[model samples]
Target: MSFLNYLRVWLACARYSTVRTMMFRFDFIMWSLVELFWMTVNILLVSVIYRHTREIAGWTQYQMLLLVGTSMIMQRLMMGLFWSNLFELGRNIRTGQFDFFLAQPGNPLFMVSTRKLDLDGLLNVLVAVSVVAYSAHQLGLHPGFGDIVTYILLILCGLIIEYGTLLLIVSLTFWIVGSQGIEGSYFTLFEFSRLPKEAFRGASNVIFVWLLPVVLVSNVPSKSIMHGVDARYVLWLLGVTLLWLLIGTTVFRRGLRRYASASS
Candidate 1:
């Protein structure tokens, strides 16, 4: 299919799924309330911590809020768009259901990643943005156009890095079928992403900054907004994002060749 046609199909699928989700008003309300509660709790935690110390990990209270808010938004985006479906890749491959995806004319990865949409999670993104805006107001830090642009780019890069990392883990199912252990391990790594990487010390910190790169996903953007934009940091973030994308796509394609359908 042409690029425009592919985009149209994606939009149609998203719209239909959203309509279906809207039918469950009760579930949506409950989920939204719960998300709101969590957001409140997260903000409170930052407030309490900053009451004792002026800064945590070289960031002020407001800056930390920005970090937390941005991280929450990124998490919501992943959950709403990619997480629900990507996790099913392993099972589909094992059951031969992936054959349907293989037959699709559009990018199989894109199709699989966006097979489902969670509207509740999308709403959480709004909550996160609200927190970020409130934090910015409290800090009295008005960002410039360039800072806003870089912030947007960094957020996009963050999402891509997160999705790519999750896909890389799920792709391992090709070799390790029935690996429930992998799921737990993956979530554990993701949990680490919630905290500022600067909180970690020594080699562990080094690993997060370079190898895992989750720090760049959230902390860097928050810092850029709260502090000032650093050209070197932005360049490094772009480079890491591209590298991860290349590595992730390479790994997924290589694994595709070894994916044996259930019929085999």
Candidate 2:
């Protein structure tokens, strides 16, 4: 199908999902509040840390805040857009609920990845931007249009890399059956993302930055805007993102071939 038609279907799914979640008004409000509360707490924690130290891993106070804020925004955006639906892989596979996705008109993986939307998670976006803006103000940094555009591009790349990583992890459910530890694993890995790459050392740095690449997700975007995007970093990030996307898509398709239909 054409890209336009594909997007149309996704929009329909997103609309339905938003409407369904809106039905539980109380739950939705509570979840939104919880997200906002945690975001504030995160900024506060960073504030406290900065009070004690001037910099962590070459990042000054405001820069660190920007990193944290970028991470917060990226996490909420990711969870709101793709994480929840993709993380349902194990349960869907085990309960045979994925059979319906397989029966859909388009790609089963596409259907599975985009069917649900998290309205509450998206609401946290406002808090994220506020934190970043406040941090920028504190640093007295006046970002230009070029910086803003580069930062956005970098963030989009980060999102794609992250989404690809989630797909790869969840695709393992096809082989391991009930294995969903990957979802929790992904969450745990985000700890490294919120910190500057310089904060890590030796093997830990190498592993997180090169192997897993959580640092590239948010910290890199902040760094790109703060220091001006480096040619080396941009090339490296794009390469890794492409690699992850290829790996994830290949694994998902292979896993699908192994699937046994519920009807069978």
lDDT of 1 at 144: 86
Worst lDDT run of 10 residues, candidate 2, spans 178-187
- When summed lDDT is taken over every stretch of 10 residues in candidate 1, the lowest stretch is 179-188
Q: Estimate every model's Cα lDDT from 0 to 1.
A: 0.81, 0.84
Query: Candidate 2 local accuracy as lDDT?
Result: 0.84
Once superposed on the true structure, which residue ranges of model 2 sit more than 4 Å away at CA?
262-264
Best by TM-score: 2
50 Cα displacement, candidate 1 (Å): 2.8
Q: Which lDDT tens digits does candidate 1 get at residues 1-264?
A: 788887888798899878888898898888778877877887898889888999877777877888889888888888778876877887787677999998998888888887788888888899898888988998998888988888888889988888888888878887777765574555566555557757888898888766787777887788788878878888888888888788877888888998867774
Name the TM-score of candidate 1: 0.92
Error of 2 at 37 (Å): 2.7
